[model samples]
Target chain A: MNLLSIIKRFAYDLQGLTFYSFRLFGKILSRPMYLMETFEQMYFLGVGSLFLVVLTGVFAGQGMALQFSIELADFGSKNYLGRVMVIAITRELGPVLCGLMVAARVAAGITAEIGSMKSSEQIEALRAFGIDPIRKLAVPRFWALMVMLPVLTIVTDFVAIYGGYIIAVYIANISGAVYWTNVTAKLTLGNFIIGLSKPFIFAAIIAIISTYMGFSTVGGTRGVGRSTTESVVACSISILFINFLFTRLLVPQIQGLL
Target chain B: MIRFENVSFSYGKEPVLRDVSFHVKPGETVVVLGISGSGKSTILKLIAGLVQPDSGRVLINGHEMTTASEDEWSRVRPKIGFVFQGGALFDSMTVGENIGFTLIEHTDKTMDEIEVTVRETLRFLNLSEDLIDILPDSLSGGMQRRVSIGRAVAAVDPMIMLYDEPTTGLDPISTEAITELILKLQSVKGVSSIVVTHQITDAFEVTNHFIVLHDGVMVFDGPGEKLVQVQDERVQSFLAPFMQSVKNIPAVCPEE
Candidate 1:
């Protein structure tokens, strides 16, 4: 209830998550790879989420292009729509939107699944069989999300840029060639670095927070629901906060490097 | 063989097990009796190394498990199979996969060989081969419990198997069948066991040795017949309700 206690709980959660991430990293690098399970997770998470990601990208790109075109028209340079769209979509909105949306979908599902397993004693059963649940259950999801998020980000970036193309060329009456040229003009290495880095970081954060909430679930079905809700909320807040830090701190540094 | 030496455990400030001690020799069966929250399952959990004691010791096959690392416990764990009361099958996995999980994870056997072993395990459990492809949720409680046992026994010759409330929620026929299956495993595989249950008849049917726990403390430990003779009021009270039910049963039916 108090701010101090809240801070303490958050610190405690971070500590547990750090240890969990360490153990996960150890298992992921070592022997006993669950390649089939990893591939299964990829298909489930990546392919399963393709539609959602694409939809988010489309609306984001279209809206940004249209809004920027209207603003630039007052300055007699509506042609700058594509350039502005590319910068906003690729550098900031694309990865962040994709991260948050996927985090919403995936984090809840992971927590619910693993939380139910925890309540059912299935988690304990895995350990009793001489298998670590982290290695068997969490490892596959971790690797899957790690691999899938970047790939999904690419899909999102591509779809978003295309959506910008549609809005600029058709709705805004900008020439396709000029639109694409402006889009490429803003596609700097700095932009790519900032855009791509967030998803991987977001992936790690989502997997760690969701899986941690899951394993720590206490009660029964009520516990499962509570943890699932907390997993999504924590993941969304963490993703947004990290995105802010990434933009504020990393962007200037990346721009300096460029 | 499994042995506990004055093992005490508490989930929080409240102790779940208080200075409990017992031993199961190789190829022997010991039934642990207790009501809900009486620490019967905790004893089994301790032996399985799922939880360590707050004080004292747990020796599983000569290793002091209280101090064992996860890796050490992993090495020793496969020798002990645990059957949770609720079956605890992986719902995502089908019945065959559940039974073959251990082999699939730990053994070098091919899928075909594993399938054969699963079939053999199902046969040993007296379950039909047709049930292998179904999900665990679809099966009756009794069938699920049997499949759980089959899964435990499917992989290796488990030196010790721990069953927690194995017949708690089954019909009389199912209860009798589960008790018989436990007996069958002991007779056929020579597997040692510690069966936990509040089902007095099923507990009595499964073993000669009995250990009773009340309020997180061991109330009685001795042969099954001697359990009734213990002057402990807590032990008598624990058995009182089940005893009345047993007494009401007619010795012979009219048809007999």
Candidate 2:
């Protein structure tokens, strides 16, 4: 396809996704809300995703500490390893990695489930029964992700920090007091806020893109598979892109706070 | 009652329905007979407000469905029940939950009230109370379709019910059960209905009025005997394959 056609198709898709997301938001604010379904989704998306987030956070923190400790020891600044780990993990790597992991797991599953429903005409059946699929299906998942991602990010931050502490004090032979002192000196409230804010944006991206893919799915089972793959790829890329934009915008304001 | 006024619809460049016009009176059952891709199911979708026609108007119980907004459509939807060809039961939910979905979401009834209605609806369809907690996939195809019908009729008494190829993939006994259920609903509930199917014998068994669609146009619109007497070569050619089976079965018209 020509570049102009490709650009046109991209714009069309963006427009559709934006329209669908706004419609879902409107339904969520309307009356007769699906409170029970929302709680169910929170359990499914939040509690179900906890183990993977914890695993990813711990390993990422340990690897960063180990690599940085060796590099800093060459310059005889090994005591600063804790400072580096705290700053990087808290302000940058923690939220972004957690978002990516959740996107891969949760977004793909949401797309596949809804796509299958669409293929089977269950989505249409919802409308036929006077129940909007957006209100019954999409709204619950959207609110659940919004409420859960920030909570997951907080848990990830604590787990990763402890993992870094383990590697710094036990493996790197840094004195525990000295390591913690440096870490506390470098970590600021502004850093924590910036990190916590990222998962919210990522959550929106994953939920909106995955649900849109499912809603627009056609054909049948083969079409559902294609939609799932597209949802995951689109969510991952959008999260990374938005992460950079958020960082660039927030970093300056956070620096002023610090 | 439902009315289609010169409704024309197409998927991209291919026309599905071209200037098709028909109406079903209150308490009447109209069976739409057509070959595959002849736009039989599209008629039901249009009546249920699932898809808009490319042109012309669709009216359900005097409400213009083609131009209704989402909220307006939602208000109108509960007055009509739709049975999809594959049953379209939510796989994640149990049979009882699936049947009670509309009641729970749209009504002020309590759980006990809803369960009583669910049990009554299931029993009316000859389904056992023991099958209530089982998932749809675990049921046989016939049972699943009956459960789908039960879901449609569980809550409020819809004024109109649309069935899209209700017996498309079923054995003889299962098809007989669904046909009997359709007839029972008509006699018991007095709801107007439009059944879309390619099955000739099934059509003869359930219809008071018969409409034939061919190449996106209406080829015949009359009673069951008149449908068999259609002189159009296209109509004759279409019915040729099913003619023997249709003759073997006694006509069980709703009017009779």
Tens-place lDDT per residue, model 2, A168-254, is 888999888888898888777888788888888898888899999999998899999999999999999999999898888877887
**Predicted structure with the largest lDDT when compared to the true one:** 2
Candidate 1 CAPRI level: high
How do all models score by TM-score? 0.96, 0.96
Extract clashing residue pairs from model 2.
none
lDDT of 1 by residue, A1-258 (tens): 999999999898889888988988888877788899999999988899999999989988888888888899999999888788878888888888899989999999999999999999999999899988988778899899999998899889989989989988889899999998888998888788888988999998888888889999989999999999999999999999999998999889888988
Best by DockQ: 2
DockQ for each model: 0.84, 0.86
**Worst-scoring 10-residue span by lDDT in model 2 chain B:** B247-256
Model 2 segments more than 4 A misplaced: A1-8, B248-251, B254-256
Docking class of 2: high
